[model samples]
Target: MKDMLIDDFQYTAQELLIRNKSILDLITKYQDSNSRVNRAIIKAVTQCGCMTISAHKQEIPDDASLDEMKTSVESHIEGLLCENCRDAIERDIGRNVFYLASICNALDLNLYDIILKENDRIRMLGKYNLR
Candidate 1:
């Protein structure tokens, strides 16, 4: 159960990845997918008018606790993604994840093992893991 999704995704990517077998191609495709993900979000904001990002400096107090910082910090993104925007973003993100799995496959790495190791590290480090 633990490795089901990650392993399956990695296997599927390896099988379906016909055009981009080269590591260089995989990395560039990964970068392209990342760009598309960003583009989808930008389109959601600028073209669709479904969401807006209001960038500003975070003003968390110096003495604030971790919990306080978590509460005070804001994403500054307003509104929800419309169905069209949501679908586009999801599709782009899926492509990004696929490329990531393909890269792992090329390197003879197990995506599930990587994810599990990262999870273990985060759990072990807990509050101090972020830095």
Candidate 2:
């Protein structure tokens, strides 16, 4: 299984999902249907923030007044969600990207390159109505 901490581990998509299955399930169980969709995106941003903090070995001070951790978790995952249902599409996108990246890394594929290429292709051949 690929370790999120390291870049060297090889993990298949199914394997990685199985490892983080609890988080996915938690999102579904705790959040409403709308939130469920965006949960993945929220998780992505959260994971990115967590990874940066971990990399810098930053710690929340005991005297810290604000819940920085909580804020970080909610960044880019609150306002854009469905107003009526509170779904976080950003979080969902992030989660999907993170998962895809891990799997691609395992397969020795370039994540950024693939993303850019696909994005360009989509722009060139837009089909579906955005809303």
Best by lDDT: 1
True-vs-predicted CA distance for residue 36, candidate 1, Å = 0.4
**After superposition, which runs of candidate 1 have C-alpha atoms over 4 Å from their true positions?**
none
Predicted candidate 1 versus true structure: per-residue lDDT over 1-131, tens digit per residue: 75897788899999999998999999999999999999999999999999999989999999999888888989989999999999999999999999999999999999899988998999999877755
Question: Per-residue CA lDDT of candidate 2, range 41-118, in tens?
Answer: 445346433221123344556665454543433222222323322244555544555555555654567655665687
What's the TM-score of every candidate structure? 0.95, 0.31
How much lDDT does candidate 1 score? 0.94
Cα lDDT, all candidates: 0.94, 0.46
Candidate 2 CA-lDDT value: 0.46
lDDT of candidate 2 at residue 94, scale 0 to 100: 47
